[model samples]
Target: MRIPQIRLESTKAQIGLKTINAVNNIKQPKADLSIEQPKAELTIRTTPSKLTIDQTQARADVDLKSVVKRMEEFSQKGYQDLLAGIARRAQQGIELMKIENGGNPIATQAKQNSQKPMKEFGLGFIPSHGSVKISYEPARVDIEVAPNKPKIHVNVNKPIMEYEPGKVEVSLKQKNELNIDFEMIDIKA
Candidate 1:
């Protein structure tokens, strides 16, 4: 009996090589960040105004006019009474002269009717001015005020904006597949 054996072995092998090239369609996302500005406002207004005042003052014035008028009347009456007294004294002088003249009634009446006669040679003195009475009262003052007014006002305003974040997505794609295999043949003896 004879037998034969054949062993299959491989030292080196070169298989086919495959390369894949693919293009992905992608667009840049919209601008992620956003900004908002603050708001401010100012306003001013004004109006004209006016005022007035009245005042009165005096240095020498009577406080009670009615009382002053009464006093004037009294002074007039007193002046009349003093004049009557002077006339009575003159009449008494004339009567005394009549008695000194041995009761000469005609001459006494004539002297009393005539004005007083001045002596031609006698020492007599006459004043230039007569005495006068002075009268006065305290002063008075009064005051008053009136007017219109002033005011202030203020106003405000505001502005604003909203913001949002960006989004991202990820995925995979198949380009190619690689398959390699080996087989053994029949052996006999």
Candidate 2:
């Protein structure tokens, strides 16, 4: 009888792997878009306003204090002249009427007495005083007028405004990492 020898063996483990290759298309997309509202500033400056008004009335006053006295003097002078003319005309008319009524009485007596021419006798024929000219001057009066002026004033005011916009900030993402995994194709041969 032949005796068989016993043997023991151990095998090492093996792994099959594939490669990893890729292009990272990195684009920092317009750094987190953000916006802020606009703001406005106002400034006001002023000048003090003032106004003044003045009024004047036109007037023309008549001072009639001495008018009466002056008119009276003129009236008195006219009256005197008129009266003198009337008296003179009246006397002349009376004398002429008397002479007309008593016509040729003295001539009849002279013819009866002597038939020849008698001595000259004077008749009552008195002449007037003087040949005067009458004046007809009237009185005078006057009035005056004056004017006045008015004043005016003016004032003004103004306003101003200013506008501005807020600022914008930009930033990017901080940290990142990559990972991978592996496995065996065949086992237990």
Candidate 3:
């Protein structure tokens, strides 16, 4: 009689690994600023000088009143006195012609002869005097000045940063291969 044989077969599982790298990102923005400036101020003022003059004394140097009076005295000649004497003599002659006390003709003639010629004497004096004067005033000046300062302003913004946390992933791509097999065969006689 021949004996019978039995057979067995088996297979093992496999494992695989996959890797990924982490990534990081960062970003920042710039800051801002502002400024302003002003101009300066100034002022100035002035006054002019003045002068004055007077001339009262210089005008009275040459006067002519006394000279004119002396000239008039020479031109009249005594005509006034001659007329008076003639009238008196005529009166005495009329008295004599009237046969009154033999007429005092001789006495009248003597009185006329005794009388003085012309009237008024001496001349009047003229006036002349004084001097000149001058005066002056000084000038004045004033000045003022003021200065200005500039203004400045600034503003800064905080840096804006964006960050992504690093990430890592682990996965199996190909499983580790492991195989096992069992087999049995029958013999012939």
Best candidate according to lDDT? 3
Query: Candidates' lDDT values, in order?
Result: 0.48, 0.44, 0.57
lDDT of 3 by residue, 1-189 (tens): 344444434344434434454444445555566666666676777787788765533333332235555466444545655676578678767765776656566766677668866897866433233344667787777777777776767676766555555555555554555454444554565
User: For residues 1-189, could you state the per-residue lDDT of candidate 1 as single tens digits?
Assistant: 333444455444344444443434444444444344333332333333333321111111222335566699689999998998799778777776668557776565677657665668955333212222333443443333333233333333333333343333333343344444444454555
Model 1: how far residue 161 lies from native, Å: 68
Output the better candidate (2/3) by TM-score.
3
Scored against the true structure, residue 55 in model 3 reaches a CA lDDT of 53
lDDT at 77 for candidate 3? 44
Error of 2 at 19 (Å): 99
Q: What is the total number of backbone clashes in candidate 3?
A: 11
The candidates, ranked best first by lDDT, are: 3, 1, 2
Stretches > 4 Å off in candidate 1:
1-65, 101-189
Best by TM-score: 3
Candidate 1 is scored at a TM of 0.20
What's the lDDT of the predicted structure labeled candidate 2?
Answer: 0.44
What TM-score fits each model? 0.20, 0.18, 0.36
Model 2: residues with Cα > 4 Å off, grouped in runs: 1-66, 100-189
Clashing pairs in 1: none
